[model samples]
Target: MSAAASSPASPAALTSSSRLAWLDALRGIGALAVVAEHMLPWFVPSLRPYWFSLGVYGIFVFFLVSGYIIPASLERHGDVRAFWISRFFRLYPLYLAIIVLVLALAWWVPVREAVVRDGSAVAAHATMLLDVVGIGGVADTMWTLSYEMVFYLVVTALFLTRGHERSGTWAIVFAVAAVLVGLVASGAVFGGGWPAYVSCAVFVLGLTGVVLGRLRTVSACLLGVMAVACLLLSSRVPWLGAAVLAVMFAGTAIYRWERGTGPLWPVAVTAALVVVAPVWAIESGWWWVRADVWLTTIALAAATFAGGMALRGRRLPRVLVWFGLISYSLYLVHHPLLKYFVQVSGDLRQAALPYQLLMTAVALAVIIGASALTYRFVEKPMQDLGRRVSRRCRGGLQGGGEARVPGEDAGDDRVLGHQERQVPHGVGDHVGQGDTVG
Candidate 1:
């Protein structure tokens, strides 16, 4: 055997895998929660729990992680163009692949009714603003991508505006907006396909401007406005979308406090406001959004994240970390895979308990196995290429790097085992699996 394989892992190798093992552990847990959330209903309804939506809880965990780590991904590299490049390759390839997969399988597994066929779906998806624009995702879980993309746009703009440090302020702003919109808005305020159409154009144009270095700030600003506008005017519930964004920024605020660059109070305020945003929304009917249930889910998700942070220095289980590496794929592929199973195998809910358990095991194994393969073949290669491309553009966007704090290194790409690029890939709250899949 080679010496490299014979000896114990070097300190550097251990550091690479163990430093952010906690984050990966969280990702793995959240993805599995979502998978179980979707899977139990189809294969074994009796096994499904009714307290808090597993999907919602899992999504919240994901949002928190993304909020915490994304800024570091941007600042560590210190470049706007490269940041976007890395993000694009991180998400879009898998995202587009899922879309194609869904369409091709649409004949076997019926597409969700909310998915528009009038070209609007394509437009909404182009911006990853599918749910916010009143269009359905190719996969139900993809609605979360809209908000993820929005957060990225807003963060990019803030980084360029020298306002990146004001994470708490933005968190509060969105929290307040969520409540205000929840009170006054009813259903989607922006109707028709125009919002998707217009936003798609802006999305493309803004991204181009940001990348090419011509009026990049203005471009980012436009993208930011487009993002916020879609959230307020086009989401299924105005407050829900706003509150989700608030959760992401609240994650950022907490991160700032950890870096000693900010105070801890903003997180408290944002949390309070987000808790209240959907309580009295005009569209509030779902039992899951009841103030009590929502609070419980949010609190639990927060606690899970805190627990992970507390354990950050310790070596986590290797299986969990591997699950995290394939989490994005697991999250995206599981729902469609479930749909196909239901369609082909018929509902297993009536099957004997032993048979149901056996089927669930087989289905989960298939989902995890497929996810691992995709992560290896697709996500890993693209992420590697993106990092290389980003390295060449080091020092960051000509204007954006100034906002990154001096002497405050947020992450080590190698030390984190390339998990930084995986931040945006988790969770989408399409009201969980019982209602919708995303």
Candidate 2:
């Protein structure tokens, strides 16, 4: 399909309902940033400032986007079962394939051990419990997945209790409130260890923005400012709360006063953050910029939000859209692919830069190819099967006059459910397919 053709189905088609292009673009950018972060060692001896900024900031954008998109989709469908079904069908097949590939590569690669840590990271990653215990996956990057799952569970529980609208609202309220309370409770000033809470809150924040996005220009900006403010307060900022308030206040001013909303402002702001984050981090001299580093990530998250705002309802090229689609697969497997490639390429004593760059490019190309293959032959087929099974199971439930049990209808479709929409290829009632950066 042409790039334009691949832009998600238009919002006009859905009438008042619109597709969020910013989120898709942000997702694409986030995934690409992650891949690029992995590839950074090859190009620069000391990591570039921009690369560092993108690395930390990129994940926040992923979290924010995920917060907005997943619940929004669930609300769109309204059927809890269908929502879960869609999520699973979309994420699992490709995830499973990656897990298998990672396992296979374990025997041949040494760096893979560093990424996975041991068989446990793989096991933890496989279970999607990486964040709960904080061990993460072999990929190291999959830590976000753990944070994401906790939010999903929160959403799922709420959905089960109340329908999407009420539950989503409550989820947001509770999440925001919980974040505020957690900040107070932590007594760390900037809310230490609140990434877990921020994970859930940001998703709520994105959801809140989605709920209020189209109401009016003011409302959109207000909500966006609120989200940014919450994030600022949640992290370890240099000036702490004051800086957060200043940025949000300034952002609000832009929204209120700035006329002529073209893509440039957002693009500029986003680009600025993208460039500045790494430089600032290097300057600060923080080693890894742990959970305390959320201050740094805010700009990328905001840039993504701005990008999402700009792209709303407009289509980009199809190929870019597909990249967004298979991003999860690409993300899950990119670590292993790069690790193996780097290890093998180490033997080439030629100019390390050219050799590494060439290999990185080749690895990325292979990842894309593998992702496409997985999407076509694995994800799509399983998703189809899942939908069919869900329909059949739903029909059976209605016919038999009984409620459905979680795994009662277990089938290939379990891998493709709507709520199963994001990446955990393993362990969940249902998983979502879209957000893969974690």
* Backbone clash count for every predicted candidate, in the order shown: 7, 42
- What is the per-residue lDDT of model 2 for residues 298-399, given as tens digits with 9 covering 90 to 100? 655576666765666666666655566666766676766666665666532235566656665677788788767866788768878767755554432111
Error of 1 at 16 (Å): 5.6
Query: How accurate locally is residue 244 in candidate 1, as Cα lDDT from 0 to 100?
Result: 82
lDDT of 1 at 65: 86
Computed on alpha carbons, the lDDT of every model, listed in order, comes to 0.77, 0.45
TM-scores for candidates 1 onward, in order: 0.90, 0.58
* Candidate 1 residue 406 C-alpha distance from true site, Å: 3.9
| lDDT by residue for model 1 (305-405), tens | 98887777687889998888898888778888877776767667668999999988988888889899888988889888887787677655475434443
Q: Which stretches of candidate 1 lie over 4 Å from their true place?
A: 1-17, 281-283, 395-397, 400-405, 408-412, 415-438
